[model samples]
Every structure is written in structure tokens, then in C-alpha cells.
Target: MDWQKNLLIAAIIAVLFMLVIRWNDFQESLPAANAPVSSAQQTDFNASSDAATAGDIPSLPGTTQAVPVANSTSTNVIKVVTDSLVIEIDPQGGDIVHVALPRHYDALNTPDVPFVLLDNRDHHTYVAQSGLIGANGTDSAAGRPLFTSAQTEYRLADGENQLNVDLVFQQGQTTITKRFVFTRNEYLVNVDYLIDNRSDSVWSGNLYGQIKRDSQSFHKVSALEMNPFLGAAITTNDENYKKLTFKDLNESEFRTVKQGGWVAMVQHYFVSAWVPDANQENNYHLRRIGNQDIYLLGFTGPRVEVAAGSTGSLSTSFYAGPKDTERLAEISRYLDLTVDYGWLWWIAKPLFWLLKFIHSFVNNWGLAIIGLTLVVKAVFFHLSATSYRSMARMRKLAPKLADLKERYGDDRQKMSQEMMKLYKTEKVNPLGGCLPILVQMPVFLALYWTLMESVELRHSPFFLWITDLSVKDPYFVLPLIMGLTMWLQMKLNPTPPDPMQARIMQLMPVVFTFLFLWFPAGLVLYWVTNNTLGILQQWYITRQIEKADTTA
Candidate 1:
């Protein structure tokens, strides 16, 4: 009976523990509401020009004026299609204005519609911008240099491994070629500025890359669901990874210099980052545009000087795609941290790896979750057996405890003392059951994050009506099964001596069922599998203990 009370306390503590973590992220994920734009702000945000002011760009040592914005005119837009991506680049500044993932659909019902990541449409504004700034730079306060491309559209042909799209800008005796190199089945695009300066004087400029976006969430989150982080993340010299929310940027500008670290705009399951040359020192910055909801996260490389009659190039890699941990890791150091498993990433990483390994063989995410649950239970079998044995001993002593309660009806202190004596004589620890649950809390939380943060689970299907593992179960079947299994597991444990406590313990299953109804189906399936396995294990242990007592 005391063990049951401890079990209830443990369950409540576990829920509170997870809530504490989720609440912090939810607060950070809350973007400032889309504020009404003033007349001047409206003009600055005009969809037609889409140009950046000089203040929007990072300045060089001697150059006060900096970056320019790309014009969104149809004549300046170039469309490029590959196996995995459909992208729109504006030749005005050779900036990537829009990106759609052809492999990842916008919604389950729309099979042919691709998920748009970066868009410069009227409703939302998010785009990747890059340019050269400083003395002799083509981009200035006046306007961005308009480049010309051979064609307005390009498609990666079958059997082609790479596609190159080039935009050329020419000024007296100087030619600048902006080239984008895309590889098949890859999301990283190589952006290079090839400068040929035949002028008498040396040409000097600093290459800067940035992501500009409005502080508005693209995904719709329900009240019951945990809001994922939607902000900017970067790597620094002192810290491997750091996140800057739009609120933080609004409060104060963030500036740091590191030896070729990355800056990225991160969302639910996708990220876009600018990874500069690792060998060079770069300056990273994050700030909100003048009283507007717009935020910029970018980096400025050191100034490059091309001698007269010589040729030189500056290069940076831009990644826009799903948060694939392995691929991100290959792109840059600590870039995979964008996957964001919270503070317990050490535990989550291994769990994700095991799940992926299981999925590889089973070929189903649902089955992999079940297998992962089984493996976790197996790993904790000994500790669980210890707890169940203690619970079984308590169940055997339930009759004596009731008799003692009846004898000392109104003596609370006396009852407590006698209960302690009885527990001691029976060699049973009332707190034993709580240890197993407390010890397993981290693993449970890690699994929750793994299911939530993994892009592989998005739009993945289980059997029947569960078409999306990342979303709630359409039929609520898995959550109901989870509740049933939880109830069965509770039945295996000893009933509490107090009527109120017993009722409270009985209500846990119902409350959890309602709470889990809106949870992702994959997570609900895991709970069902775990509760069922626990029920079987506890039932077997209790039966063995009772049979031994009967023999005695």
C-alpha cells in the first residue's frame, strides 16, 4: 500500500519533470506577434523591391556602406530544379529567395506539393542573401548589382551528378561570376564569387552571407502540443552551440567572432545554415531589423583583395534541408546540434541511433519504436525485478496491514510506527518501487525528444489509419490501447490501503489517456508497448512470489 503511494508520487514527479523542460522551450518558441507595419515600414517591406538597406549589412574596416537586397522581379528570378530540391534565385544579388523540398511533401494529402522552406512571398518573408561588400564592392547603398544568367530556368538532367548555375555581373574592366553548385541527392549548395579584376587598381571586398526572416512561425501548434524552437542558432568559440531567439535579438544585438563557425536559422525539423571556410576567421551577427519583426543571422568573412590582372574566388556553403544528423555533421562541426534533443542529448543520440538501426532491418518506424521499447525494458529487467519483488512482498503483507489498521482505528502515529515495524520485519522497502521509475525518467524523456525531433518520422506511416507517425493518431486507437495497458499494469501492483489514495491511483490511467490523445502516435505506441511489457513482467513476478508463499 505504501509502495503504491510512492508509485503515484513518482509518476507525478516524472510528469512535472518533463513539463519543466517543455515549458522552457515553449516560452522561447513564442514569437512576437506580427506587428502592424507603419507606412514607412510597409515601404521598407515592399514585396516588389525586397532590397536591404546599408544598415542591414556588416561593414568592412574602411567601408561604411554595405549589403544590398535582391530585387524580386520575375525577370531577375532564375528557377533551378534537381532531384531533391526546387530553388529560386534572384540575379539582382545572386540570392536564394525560395526553396522547396520535392522529397518532403507539404502535407500528407498533397502528395505532389512540395514543402516550401524559404519563401519571399507577400505573407511570409524568409530568404538566404549573400554579397560582396567594402571598397570597390558592386553592392552599395544605391542598389544591388543586377547580374545576368544565360537562361531563366535550369533542370538537373537524369544521370547528372552535379548542376551549376552561374550569374555574371560586369563593371569597367572587372567581371564577377556568382556560381551555385548543387549535387544530386544533397541539400548543400556551394556559392562561389569568382572575381577577375583587370583594372589598374586592386579590387577589395568582404564576402557576407546571411539568412533574413520574419518572426512568424510557419507551423501551427496546438495547445496540447509542445512548441518546437523557431529561432537562430550558431557555434561560438566558448560554446559549441547557442540559440538566439527573436526576442533576444529584439532586446539586443548579438555579435561574436570565431574561427569559421556557422550561423543558422533553425525550425521544427529543418535548418538553413551558412558554413564558411573553416580555416578563416569569420564574424557572426544576429539582430532584429529597425523596429520590425524581421531578424538576420549572418557571417562576414575577411576582406579579399584580387590584384590587377589576376583572378581569385571566395566561397561559402549554404545548407537548406531536413535536419539529417549524419549529413549535417558531415557539413560542419556541431551543425548536427541543430537537431536539438534538449539538454539530455547524450542519451537521446544513442536512442535515435538504436531506433534507426532497428528501423533499417524492420523497414517500419512503428515496429522500430516497439523494438526500441523492448530493448529498453530488457536493459532494466534486473532493477525492475528488484522493484516488483519488493511490491510482491508488500502485497503479501496487505492483510496484516489491514488488521493493524482495524486494531488502531484512530491512532495515526501508532499506525505509522507499527507499519514501519511490519515493513522492517517483512524485509520489504516501501520506497523500492519508486527507485526504478525515478531511474528510468531520463530514458523516457530522451525517447520523447527523439520521437519529436527526428525528421525521419515525419510523414512516415504505421499500419491502418496511422498515416503519419509524427502527428496524433487519427482514430485514437493507440492512445486507448496505452490506457488499457497502463490499467492492467496498475492491477498487477498492490492496491493502496487508503480509499482516497486508491481512487487517485485508479484515475491515473484515465488522466494519462486523455493527455496522450493528442500526442504523436509513435510516442503513444511506445507507451502501450512499455506498459504491456511491464504488466507481463510484474504479473509473472507476483505469481512466483505467491506460489512460494503457498508452498511454505
Candidate 2:
């Protein structure tokens, strides 16, 4: 019975882990929509020529535009350095060509190369582009405006909290000021379009912010690890977070009008989002560029009228950085949803709060995880105690059950009836331990995701040899120890009479150890701590049961 219960638990966990790993495959196999983009759609987003007129611009808003002004490796990049970020802005389309986090390294050991989020490299193209798109606007024509910047390089000065990089586009008396405002220690940058209508009665146009990216994975994961989602997501009136895949873009164009919302490109650990004015009515759209794997997620704001001899402005903040839940929440509503914890967010949120609180005192993330696990176990102590007591009673009835089995021989029905009689006489519930473990599965899964998705745990050190909690242990120590404790827990329960069940019970720990060897060290730590606690409680309960039997 004990062997069967342990086998079942092991099987359930393995199935769940595999299901999560294959989730993306399931999504990719879904059928495409009827109106998939044709070759004609690719021409709509073709690269604009240098000599271009307004006719080249598409009538539809939020259309994907090729980077026609400059190609990758061109000497036309404007680099700006802030306290927390290194950015490269291209004047051709006034696009953010490159963004790197100076505070975070690309890998655990590589301290020199920062994590590059957005770049215009030959192999990859992920840039944030924004400009005016109407009468007298910068990008109103098919040809992107080649604005001139005052300086090619700018760095945040000492004690400076704000920096501005202004690209000026002037045609006679009409001037369009494309200003990029960056703040110290913040990832949000203000992209503003200032329209100075000097020789006009009323200049009418719309401002657009878009992120263009090729289908490329930012981080390459191992076989056992699940790749983070790489696609577009938007917040709408009905749904808090709606994921728009590349396939979805190819199938058909999507447009939604909302008073306040956001459009974003998400990846593992990091996200880049456009948060517009909450009171402004904006149209959000997604589309694919022809057969090329290029996709765009963007927003077009309401038309603005810049009166004669007056200056008008439309602005939105672009957040490009790590998916810090607190920081993203401060930027916009439901923005923290980018740090996806799956359908278990309700449990993961509180679990994160507890882990964060514990880390405040312990000053070590590994210790904080251990502390949180202990607290969770303590909260369910009584329920677990009842389960252990029932198991102990069952173990005490093993001799009688064995006698019934011998008497019934091949008669399975009579054996089951005798076993039920003995169970009723002793008031022992066979499924008590299993029910308690099942109840705790959601908590376990939530905590697992919390450990996996938390960027704070990335490259964090625990103790000797456990340098990075976000990655697998180099020596596979924690997982091996976890396997040992699981085996010890099995030993505390009554041995199964069935040889096949006993063999399965003997092998489950080994199977789990192999699976966990590639798992993150932080997750393995949580499991190891949990299994050790369970073994201690079960050992104590078994001792108490034997003492009672000897007294009787």
C-alpha cells in the first residue's frame, strides 16, 4: 500500500512537469486563421526608399514598416548611457536600436558583457520605433525621416537624474521634435513628439509607438528547461493579459480601441512595454510583415490638432528592462502580469510575499526559501499530523492484513472484504496521507514557479558550490540529497507485499533524482528541505506507534 501511494505521487508529479515543458508545442500546433497574411501584405511593409512621398505611407494605422533609413552595422547609431542602462537610438526612424542592462550580466560568470535585450544585429532585429503618423508628421510618408541629433554620444552626468536626446526634423517653418527622455535608475523612457505648427492653420496627425522584432529567442535553454514565451501581449478591457503569437499575427490583423491599456513584447525574464496615457483613446494593433518572420505590436493615439503658431505634444512611456513585479506594477495597471506564474498566480503571489519577507531577515535567498518552506509546513502541521497518524495505524495493522491475504489466497474479493473489516475495526483511513499530499500540490507548484520566474534569484549564491540558484547545481548535490530523503521516507512506511509495487517504490527516488539534476538549485533546495521535514515527522510518528503497540 505504501509503495503504491508513493508510486502514484511520483507519477503525478512527473506527468505535470512534462506537461509544462510541452505547453509551447501544444500552442504551436493550433490551426491558423482563414485570413492569413498573403504575399501582398509583405509589400505593405517593404523597406522605404530615401526619396519618398506621403503616398508610400499606408492608410491603415499601426502598420508594420521596414527599417528603410539605415541597415544594421551602419555608422548612424546614437548611443546614450544612463545610470542603469545603455541605449542606442537610430535617427532614421527614431527607433531604439539597442538596449543593454549595465547592471546585469549576460551570464553567471560573464561579468563583462551585459545582457542585451534589444539589438539591430544582422542575426536579430528587435527595436522600439515611434514617430508621428499623419499630416505634417515625421513618419507620415513611406520614407522615414532622417533627423539629426546634436551629439552622437551622451552619458548621464554625476548627480543627474534625467537626460534628454532630441532629434530635430525640420522642413521649412514646420519642425517636429522627437524627444527621448530617460531617468536615472528607471527603465521607463518618455518618448514625446512635439509638433510646432508655424505656417499652418491647424496641423492634424497621430502619434504611434511600435516594437518590431524578428522571430528569435533571446535565451537558449537546455533540453530539460522550458523556454520563456517570446511573443506580443496586450491588456484589453475584457482580459487582463492577452497573448498575441506570431502565428496570430500572420493569420489576420488585430485591432482594439481602449481608453487606457498597454502593448508589449515579452520574453524570458525581461519585457519591453508601451504604456500610453491612461485617459487617452488609443488603437492597439498587431500584424505580420509578408512572408518574412517580422512581427509588429504597436499603438496609435487619437488625432491631435496643433493650432497655428502653437506647440503641441503627445507622449508615451516605453519600459525596457527586467520584469520586476513591483517596478512594473508602478509603471501601469496589470503590467506585473508579465512575470507569468501561470494559472497559480494567486498562490504564487502570497508565496512570493512570504519568501521576500524571509529574505529581509536572513539576507540570503536560499535561507529565505528554506524559511518559507518551514512556515508552509508548520501552517499545515495538524493536517499532516492526522495523515501521519493514519499511516501509523495502517502500519500497525499490517500483520492482520497479511494474515487475511494468506487465508484468502487467490480469492481477491474475500481478501478485500477482510481488509475492509480490519480497517473499520481499527478506524484507519488508507488514503489520509495521499489526500494531504494532494492538497499541498498546488502550493508546491506555485512555489516552484515563484523560484523559477523570479529574476532576483538569478545568479544568486546560496553556499559553497551552489553559486547560482536560478540554474542547475554544477555538482548535483542538492538533488541527490533530496532523493536520499525520499527513499528514507519510504522506509518509514510499511513495505508493500506486491513485488512489482515494491520495485516501483524502490525506483521512483532514482527517477526523480535524474529529473531534478537538471532543475534549478533553488527548486531542488525547496524539495530537499520539504522531504527532510516529512521524514522527520514520519519517523517520530512511527516511533510513537511502535511504543503504543509495545505498551499494549
Candidate 3:
């Protein structure tokens, strides 16, 4: 085999190795692994609401006005209402997303609510930790203090309606500006931080804040988790992501996952909270980038720290909206950060760029997927052609391989080596049949992740009987046709010569068909289309080879 083909096959094996490693990571991170739990973060916070200062934030009718603090320094006030959030940001340093918890939440339906009720005293905010981490590690105000700094200073805007808080850490030499955005819709309030360092030395810290929920029953789930392996693990923690809703896994036995970049999408029906990053020392979630598990998309990127006397900015866009993909995608890529394309981002990203481009032209994601698929097939045609020709040649030489094998049955390895020598001398590559398929796997998986995790395909349809492309293929039609196409292509070209291997290869179509039966319709569509295209190419190659053989 040529070096290029050899490298490609070797690379594919490496990729598969990575995939197997990723698959096993969950088990290793499971609590039974007995890894050490990471320690809690150490950072101090002094927060003051803008309600006592520049009260520009609009508030919902039911929202309570900001209760005054002894000495707060902030100049913004915001009110949150049902279906609306108010956010205020200072150009240089800080910003806030105002939240309003509806007064009549009890009147609404809730599957689970906590038994313990802890709302920090009316005027004071509390301390909470979230982001990619363990459940207990996520600990949102579990009766902990809302704010951490020992001493506090409060500055109210001249208008008396707005308040500004200047939180200074004696040891850290930093002051953070936190403001309360109020919502009349509910008791929930958004606290935003504009943290800065005035110290001569570099001040590095994360934004520490908290939300005090009265309910103890808060659990997490995500719109991005489409894999059964992941869903199985989370099921133990009480999840209802897709088809396998509320099916329990062995989460209690697992305890807290200790891997870093630990994120969990806690969903209780309509409401969901996110933990984007967790303390990795004790946290145990599989990695974010390499694994590209849907749950960890937003959990990606590095644990950032600011330079000496320099300000680093990071923002989280909280969605108080419904779980609808269309609604969620409308929030920004940041909000849909759970949509991961895996390692094929090189392919997936460009594909997304193309999909978005096609979407711009046609305004339909289904059509966009088709358009994107065609473009990809076209781009890969060069490599595909090489593979097609190799498969055709293999079929042509199959009789010769049988003759050689029968002539050298006593030494299988020697027979295979001589067969390969014959193949090389004849300018035929047996690997050519497999290399293209291997080459395409990364792109295929990237697209799978794209379609599986993307809100663009969520609930989007492509013609009849396939309403939600993000969900399982409803009628099993696409997968069956996919299998049929693959079978036809297999017949048109060639398979492994070993009887068992050939039989296994013959059954591959059926295996994949059954496997894809429950996959998203979009993925099935892509595979079916891919197989149909391959069938056409294989038939053409076969015809050309037959004519050449006859002429020769």
C-alpha cells in the first residue's frame, strides 16, 4: 500500500482507539472508581445590588424592590418579569442578567421540588458554586452563605432607586461590582458581577455567586445528550433527556464524578440549570473536546485566570425560556453551547458554516442538510473515486486471490503476504477498499454530533414520516433503505475473502440498519443518502472494470 493510504488507515485505527478510550472514561469517572474528591474553590465575594442606585432596570409587577444595604456601591437597577429578563452592563467591567421568580409558581405544575426551603435573608445574596462538576459539587446555596467576603461596602446611586456594590477582598486586593436585576414574575433575581482588580499584582479568580432555591429536588439534564451510553449513566441521577425518560442508572453507587470539565444540565421538566465547569481535582466527568459528548459542549474551554492587574471577561447567558430548540437557538451559540461537533470540527465547523450559508439562502434546515451533504460528497469525490476504483480492482482480482490461496493453503500468513505482493506488483491496493471508509468516519461522526446536538435539526423535518430529525427515525424507512443500499453496494463490489469475514460483512448492513433505526432521522437520512451515492459509484466502477477485463 502507498504511504498515504497506510498513514490514513493507521490514523483511523488511532481514532478508533481514542473512541474506545472515550467510551471507557465514564466508567473510570464513576464514583466506584474511588478517585479522590476535589476540594472546594477558595475565593471571597462582596456583592451589592444596583436596586439602591441607578434603578434603570425594569421590574415585573410582582418583583420586590431592592432592599437597601448599609453601604453599597452600584449604579444600576433592573426588574425581571415573566417572559422577560433585564440585563445591565457597564462598558468597562461588569454586567447582570436580572431574574424574576413568579409569585404563583406553586400554581404551576412541578414534578419535583425540594423539601428544604432556604431563601437567604431578604436583603443579602448568598454563595453558590456551579459549572462542570459533580452533583454535590454543583451545590447551589445548600444553606451556605450567599456572599464570602468578611467586610462589605455599599454605595447607592444618587437617585436612591439604584445601588452599586464595591466588594473588596482584604487579602486579594480586588473589588467586584455585583448588581441585582429584579423580576416581578417570580422570587428569582439575577445577580450579575463586574469584577475587577485594582491590585498592583495580578489578581486571578472566578466569579463566585449563588442562587438560593427553596426546593431540594433540583436535578440536571441537557438538550445535547443524544447518546444512550451517556443517558444510561445520567439516568441513575434522575434524568428524562429523550426516549428513555426517567430510566434510572446506578448514579447513587457512582457518587460524584471526579474528572474535570464536568458539566451537567439539570432539568426538572420546564426549568433547567447549568454547571458549565467543575473543579476537576475531585470532579469526575469525561473530557469535553476529545469526547465531544453532547452534555459537555458549553463545559468546554479553559479554566481562565486574569493577568496581573489585567481584566479577563467571561459571560454566561442564562435562558429562562422553554426547552424548545428553536427558542433556545434563538438565544445565541453560547446558549446552545451544548451542540458539539466532536473532533471533526474541522469538517463539522466548515459544514456548519456551509449549513448556515445554505440556511441563509433557503431558510430551511432540512434543505440545508441536503445541500450540505451533497457538497460534502462532492468534495470527497476524489478520495471516493480512488476507493471505488480499488474496490472494483479487488473484485476483478478475487478469482486470482482464490487461486493463490488454494495453491498455498498450508501457510496462511505467507499466502496473504504473497497476495499483497501480487496486489502491489499489479498496482492494486486491497486497503483502498477500506481506507476511504475509514477516512470518512471522522467527517461522518462530526456530522452525527452536529445533527445530534445541534438545535438547528431539533424537531426539524425532512419531508414525510420524519418530523423530528433529532429524534429516532419514526417509520424505520430511512435506515431500511440505507441497509438496502449498502447491501446492493456490497453485492456490486467486493467483501473480505474469508468466509466468516465475508458473512460478517454481508450482515453489516443489517447491523447498521438496526443500530440506526433509533438514531435521529437526520443522521439516517445522511447515511441513506451516502449509501445510495456509494451504490451508484460502485455500480459505475463495476461496469467500467467488467468492460476493461473483457477488453484485456
Between candidates 1 and 3, the one scoring higher on TM-score is: 1
Q: Which ten residues in a row have the lowest lDDT in candidate 2?
A: 48-57
Query: Please, what are the lDDT tens digits per residue for candidate 3 over residues 1-552?
Result: 234334644664575464333333121112211133343311111112222122211111234322222233234432222323222222112222222223213211331322111122222221122221112111122211123322232323333444333322223455544444333322223444444655676543333221212111222212322322222111112321211111222122122332222222332222223332333222222211111111111222233455557555433323332234344344332333333344565677666667778889987777777778788899888899889899888887888878776888678777877788888888997778777878787887878766755645654667777766767766778878888987888787765556655666677677677667766788778777777777787788778878988999
The predictions' CA RMSDs to the true structure, in order, are 3.3, 5.7, 15.1
Number of clashes recorded per candidate: 1, 1, 66
Q: Whole-model Cα lDDT per candidate?
A: 0.86, 0.79, 0.45
For model 1, residues 169-204, the per-residue Cα lDDT tens digits are 997899999999999999999999999999998999
- Cα lDDT tens digits, model 2, 212-262, are 887756454665666667799999988998888787888997888888789
Give the worst 10-residue stretch by lDDT in candidate 1.
25-34
TM-score of each: 0.93, 0.90, 0.52
**Candidate whose TM-score is highest:** 1
Ranking by TM-score: 1, 2, 3
- Candidate 3 segments whose C-alpha is farther than 4 A from its true place: 1-208, 211-338
- Top lDDT model: 1
